[model samples]
Target: MTPGRVIAGPGGGIPWDLPRDRAHFRAYTSGKWMLVGRKTYEEMEGWFGNRTPLILTRDPSFVAPVPSHRVVGSIFEAIELAKRNGIGELVISGGAEVYETALPYADRLVLTTVETEIESDIHFPECRDPENWTAIHREVWPSDEENDFEIILQILDRKSR
Candidate 1:
């Protein structure tokens, strides 16, 4: 996401490329159960190495291309699937709707805010309410030859009930 919370540009793809941010995303989500919308799952085709993905879609006829992947009808179904598989944590990686649906159930949010803002059609759901979350970790990375913009990576944990 950018400073403006833009996740994807008008082209329906990430507008910026930050190698460090990509690396961080890969490291953090490796071997984890990831929940994503169908469009996001399609966009990320062939990217899943050892990670399991639960793709959320309203279409009951939709089938995941990968044998290891599962198609779920909703966020709750995805969570249930993960739990049934003995997964203790599920990473919500999204394309707006999925983020919005899962935000309330999230225990932690891992976000990367790109320093610059650009025209975007897709935005991340707002979940920065101080009453609901507390920043647990934050790190800033400067722009380099491989990355066009500086990025601020943050991990916010949901406030205990």
Candidate 2:
């Protein structure tokens, strides 16, 4: 979740560099990692350690490497498992569907709105305006590479009910 910044990864706008240097990288995530899929969770292994992971999957073939992960039958099941396990912070990663299902429960959303709309087969969850949420901050940054457009990082917080 490391700071939970989301990105669309297309077009031109501003620019920012990815920090390959470990010393400068700031991790902004805590609590049990409740990832939405086996693949998505596995890809982020570098960011996880002793933190337990809740993986949502009905596929019998999906096997996680450690006992720290619990495979669930459905998205709702994973949410229940996360709550039962006392997880306060969660990040909804891709496989697309997972993000759609988990967005309802996220209190904080970090979105990267790209300038160029690269047509993808999949899209992130469509979040317009919910009664409980509002954009708290939106800052622009340059794309990591040359010719790529700028991207906007948005932080949305849940307005108190």
Report the number of the highest-lDDT candidate.
1
**Compared with the true structure, what per-residue lDDT tens digits does model 2 show for residues 1-161?**
11222332324211234442121222444444656566566656566665566777768787777766677777777767777878766666554667777777678876655555443345566665566788898877665654255656678898863
Give the clashing residue pairs of candidate 1, or none.
none
**lDDT scores of the candidates, listed in order:** 0.88, 0.59
* Candidate 1 structure quality by residue, lDDT tens digits, 77-161: 8888888989999999998988888888888989898999788769888765768788999998999899999998899888885
Each prediction's RMSD over C-alphas, in Å, is 1.1, 5.9
TM-score for each prediction? 0.96, 0.67
Model 2 regions lying over 4 Å from their true place: 1-26, 30-32, 42-47, 128-132, 144-148
Candidate 1 C-alpha error for residue 116, in Å? 0.5
| RMSD in angstroms between candidate 2 and the native structure over all alpha carbons | 5.9
**Which ranges of candidate 1 are over 4 A from the true structure?**
none
